[model samples]
Target: MIQKETTGMILRKLRGDRTQEEIAAILGITKSSWAMYERDERVPRDEVKIRIANFFGKTVQELFYTPIEHYKCS
Candidate 1:
């Protein structure tokens, strides 16, 4: 089975060794705002979503909607 990966998890993986402040500045947003997005406490506006996806060289769908495989236990 599979489940959708949380945006926070995906963002963390994409962020790698970069700091939140760095990425946020590159995206022209506040560090705390980016932190909320990565924490899944808030969703970016559509325009911000586009910027984030572009920065990562990913489509918004790919970045925010990729599914993760998981095993179900009986």
Candidate 2:
């Protein structure tokens, strides 16, 4: 699993004003899956990762490599 800090940043971006359940619905994933992602307990599949990156208007590389701050600037 990746670091919680990374997952936390991803979670914060996905959350917006929605609950985790809401975000999970938007992503077509189970609430438990979303929780696991947030907790850094599991790594999402490539397709799920792509969906998340697309939701945030980010490239996969940005999501996987760049820090949140760097992503914000691009």
Candidate 3:
């Protein structure tokens, strides 16, 4: 099966050479918060998800496809 790319991979590709602070500015969020999302230390809130998708000109699905815990394959 084809594996979906993690949010970090998509973000890294979309952000190109931009720094974390620059991306945070685009999303109107703190750099640490953006870093947390990239590091998978925390999930982004719904509003933040929208901001991320919009900033990168991607649909949320294209940017994030991680299965929730309940949906993980056994």
Model 3 residue-pair collision total: 0
Candidate 1, 1-74: lDDT as tens digits: 55667898899999999999999999999999999998999999999999999999999998777655678999
Once superposed on the true structure, which residue ranges of model 2 sit more than 4 Å away at CA?
A: 1-5, 66-74
Error of 1 at 61 (Å): 0.7
RMSD of 2: 7.5
Instruction: Rank the models by lDDT, top first.
Output: 1, 3, 2
The per-prediction CA RMSD against the true structure, in angstroms, equals 4.4, 7.5, 4.3
Error of 2 at 23 (Å): 0.9
Candidate 1 deviation (Cα RMSD): 4.4
How many backbone clashes are present in model 1? 0
Tens-digit lDDT string for candidate 3 (1-74): 76767888778778789999999997899999988888777888888898899877888877777665456688
Best by lDDT: 1
As a whole number from 0 to 100, the lDDT of residue 60 in candidate 1 is 97
Q: Best by TM-score, which number?
A: 1
Each model's lDDT = 0.91, 0.78, 0.83
Ranked by lDDT, the better of candidates 1 and 2 is 1
lDDT of 3: 0.83
Candidate 2 at 48: error in angstroms? 0.4
